[model samples]
Target chain A: MSPTNATPPSERTRVRRVAQRGRYDRETLHAIVDAAYVCHVAFADEHGVHCIPTACWREGDHLYIHGSNGSRMLKLATHGAQICVTITHLDGLVLARSAFHHSMNYRSAVIYGVFDIVEGAAKAAALDTFVEKIAPGRSREVRPGDINELAATTVLRVAIDEAAAKIRTGGPRDDEADMTREVWAGVLPLAMRPRTPIIDAAPSGTPDYVRQWHEIASANAAV
Target chain B: MSPTNATPPSERTRVRRVAQRGRYDRETLHAIVDAAYVCHVAFADEHGVHCIPTACWREGDHLYIHGSNGSRMLKLATHGAQICVTITHLDGLVLARSAFHHSMNYRSAVIYGVFDIVEGAAKAAALDTFVEKIAPGRSREVRPGDINELAATTVLRVAIDEAAAKIRTGGPRDDEADMTREVWAGVLPLAMRPRTPIIDAAPSGTPDYVRQWHEIASANAAV
Candidate 1:
């Protein structure tokens, strides 16, 4: 369930002051999350605290995370407790004249909420959802998880609540007095593009599902 | 103070595994941390737990981290509490025959220890150490932090106690039976490289300190 205090529409987080560089809208946040593959999940434990970085996939307003059943974070989350989920994309390196001014241009989202473990049929469906998120349409192509494997894995669902997205983009903004200094200043965009797919070495024709999506991603990028 | 049981020579956390896919020796681990620019620091608090991804630098077996004086994690660490510091580099995607087998090749290290705040002159030294980690000789080239700025920042040090490094590299290992499958399978090397450095807009000749390290990182890559 979403928290009642989840960021209000107007209170949504954005890059303050640098209006041109921030995006507070939900669509922008979702697009950033959709394009990324992993997230850093942080939580506190009795023995201090820890953050675990792992792969994740989103469906609607909920995020699904999987880990070994023995993982401390997973064990804690399974008890229906609040956790922090952050997804960050480092867009570029901001080289400033001043070392103190040196910073990174990045897009990041922080979500805080209690997570509920998906069990029984719900767990099975969630796994399928994760499969499709990684490689669209591949969910149905592979053999489903067997009972033993499924029982051994843990999947936790965190409802999107009280989330804030912060971003910084564009060329370096040097101090006014330093504007005319003989220093180069511009942006070097960083993008993660999919390379040729590494097919598994097993014996079988390329799965139709994999081929279809590969073609789609290529076409989208070409545009 | 470090936890008595936490000082293991080699202890794998959730992300660290010794499987054929997740193994790294001490040299590889140290090299990865030395070259990394930022690390994801995770800690827990009364309002659940928080993970803030921030810049970090290491000296010997200890890591130095600084943040806004008001940061909750900084407040907690200053009390000499245990914390988790992690550095992760995502090398590339691992496309597998099945979606479940899909993974990312990465190099990561996790250290568990209690943090001690650096104050007075020791704090200034730590700041210099941080700069040197990023640009070996550049700390002296730039103006040191003044009283106000230094006062506004909080720095904490965590000794490397229980630590482990995990790495996944090389080409994909598909199922033996899938060897003849007409699917592509190989690694697409991923790397972070420096483009032309953008100088600040102010007029000053390139600092010799910055120029000296230009060629030092030609062979290294970031995750």
Candidate 2:
């Protein structure tokens, strides 16, 4: 199941240079977007082209990102405008035998589509998704958004249209001759580990969600 | 001091919304670009707009990025083309008392400029900078690029030109009223850690530079 509601690869999101890195499988799209906490979104304004990095969350078929209603990017995105949202995860640094072949083992996705403003029940649900994405059970632990708080937020959803995932994994690929060089070449795994959460005023210790995230990430690092 | 050769925020690179976070300081530019291993470069063709995330290096006032000569992004960036390069570092998750004020602490820079193709020894030097950027002394340890490797690669340099660094640090900024809520709110520090190097074949343990980086990062996390 490539795209249940896939936009298919148009000229927009196609991975041209390293075509092999381009993957359109449904799982690839979900995995790339879900793993990353933020995305660099690009769009054109009268000032040529611009890219802004913002927090994002991936829902079932749609990706949700919200901002202050007064913000310019949110205003423009909600008007059914075209935009490009790209998420990248630097997995490891590939140190090739030759400087020219040095590459990053990463997973990135670029999705292009128009946005629609989500409101009412859907808006509240999307907010939960955003919090939960940060930590599995975070949404329930935090105070729910009140009426005025929800009113101040502007949530936009973009269908996972024209999606593409570019990934590079494993060890360096050096020329057979260069492979034997004495120079050390290998992978330095790059990862984001959750640190100790700093609470403002906790009558009751650190939250369970934060602690769970910390433990899982710590365990992974030890292994 | 600001841009010595500042591209001056054209309507293009100008930070319109939340203008307070937009910075034009020279040190800010160097700090952000130098810290990241990759950048999302955006440009337009008849096909549409594209953003390809690739390895990038900062040397003096010029930002260097290279890829296969056949790559479309490198092709467009080489010949005095207009492009946007953005780098973002997600520092933490700001769990606020209210959802409306939920924000992330991050540092991001968006640079706008036209590209110039680097040639001769400058191209080779830029590759060295790229490797050194990954690990301070990595270039010397790795085998130097051969003539064929340099010939096959295309390097582009964009002047520091119009650049803006938007940053949000510290803890959550919650509404005064919401501050008294019973909900747990705080910052979960997000950091990227370099894991142990997976060496290909090193007669003497890992190189000093790689081990140094790992130790410094590990020590900081312990603090």
Question: Of the candidates shown, which would achieve the greatest lDDT relative to the real structure?
Answer: 2
Which regions of candidate 2 deviate over 4 angstroms? A1-8, A214-222, B1-10, B203-205, B213-222
Instruction: For model 2, name the residue pairs that clash.
Output: B7-B161
Chain B in candidate 2 has what TM-score?
0.91
Here the TM-score of candidate 1's chain B is 0.82
**lDDT value for model 1:** 0.64
CA lDDT, candidate 1, residue A72: 72
lDDT of 2 by residue, A159-217 (tens): 88677888899888888888777776888888887877777766556677777756654
lDDT of 2 by residue, B37-109 (tens): 8899878776666677888889998888888899888877776667889999998898887666678888998
lDDT of 1 by residue, B1-223 (tens): 2323333454334343334434334455567778677777777655556666677877776778887787666887787666778787777666555444556777777777778888899888887887666555656655457688789889888866566666777666556655554544444444444433444442465555345424322322321
How many Å off is the CA of A125 in candidate 1? 3.7
C-alpha TM-scores of all predictions: 0.77, 0.92
